[model samples]
Target: MTLLASLTLASCSTILNNLPGVYSIDIQQGNMIDQSMIDQIRPNMNKRQVLYIMGSPMLTDAFHPNRWDYLYSNQPGGEPRMQKKVSLFFDGDRVIGIQGDFKPSALPVIKESEETTVDLPPRDLEKTMWEKITNLFGIDDIDRSTESDRLTEPGPATSEPTINYPDDSMPR
Candidate 1:
């Protein structure tokens, strides 16, 4: 009976410790500093500029007033925790040195975004309720197209075919 009880208790402990279907949320703590933001920091930059680039530091020891520590730890669900640490040493207001997981490159890295600029045609705003009602009854006879007509010099034509959308006023 003692052997049986011991076996049952051991099984219960294992099951309780790691239950299936348990959801453990991703845990993130301290300042989230990325490589891009870290790359922006330069020596001789003042405290305010460092604050702007790296954001507020996580740990500033009272004993070490000149040193600012940026600590970040992320644990996703059941995975192992990953930590990143960056320490900036300051002489009075200006930053003198930096140390940690990331170091400053000889030339500052500038990440150029791959966003393309599209010149979209003007959007046709929906007519107001009153305007719709007036138009439905043929009470409003004012020519809307000509009222706000803007004429611009024709640019070099492109080979792409133009698409004409159906008029909103016309019933489908």
Candidate 2:
């Protein structure tokens, strides 16, 4: 009975040791305002009209009711994903101007450009298969390995450090 218990404990320890690292996910949405929609907002537009056109502002300053900000961001996955932002400014009760990191030229043009027609390299099925096999067998040298190095090393001791503070009983 003791031998069986020891074997079971050892197996459980091995299984726990081999467990993968924790992963996190953040679900993001697309921008609420597109360039075309922003373009429709013209200078000297009424505050109510602007609100009707662009919907509710994303943010408003506590002290300044005249200024309104519309902001949005998204990451579609993979390294170096694209990021976008837009801001509109208002003075008094009218929209005085619109300004942000986004440029009108950078916005998707309606015209058919030659760059859009450029052909991409055809995917090699054999290469993909080899990569999958490598990944499955843990042969890939890339950081994509499921085995986490964190568990292999000893973690810092949980003992809390002592802190000293001056006594508050003394009169000023």
Candidate 3:
């Protein structure tokens, strides 16, 4: 009877997992190559330039030493998987040919987006725990100095001596 009950419970586990309300997470794997990065690649460009533009290739096979493959795939829960790839063949250190799902446009024009920088003021904070506790309890701290006095006071100076170390003159 125990064996039969165990078998019945084991069979329902699969059904429970397949229920309509069950949630599944999306999966993404390998190097993510987009159109803009792909457009930047040109024939006769060096390996260093390609590395800068495309980050790094997903797969590098020892059998084909001169080829670099960039692969990207995404599977959103129950949906079908979507894949993108680009392969570059190198002659010595320079890229010779390109292949795969994406190809560069005839006259590739890179659009630069404008960015704004904002500078924020430095944060003022109480340095010690005792000071925080005293302030919380509505009591005056030990060093009862005004804001102007605190501002005018010099910060803690380092007393440690600095030593000169040997420079790195080793060759690569």
Better of 2 and 3 by TM-score: 3
Q: Candidate 1 — which residues are off by over 4 angstroms?
A: 1-22, 113-172
Cα misplacement distance, residue 93 of candidate 2 (Å): 1.5
- Worst 10-residue lDDT window for candidate 1 reads 146-155
Worst ten in a row by lDDT for model 3: 163-172
- Can you rank all candidates by lDDT, best first? 1, 3, 2
Evaluated against the true structure, the overall lDDT of model 2 is 0.67
Residue-wise C-alpha lDDT for candidate 1, range 1-172, written one tens digit per residue = 9999999999998786578787778999999977888788888999999998888989999999999999999998857899999999999999999899987877966879899999999976788677888988888876566423534545559978876667775546
Query: What tens-digit string does per-residue lDDT give for candidate 3 at 53-157?
Result: 987888898999899999999988856899998999999999888899988877866678798889999976755777888879888737767799989989757
RMSD of 2: 37.9
Q: Model 3 Cα displacement at 54 (Å)?
A: 1.1
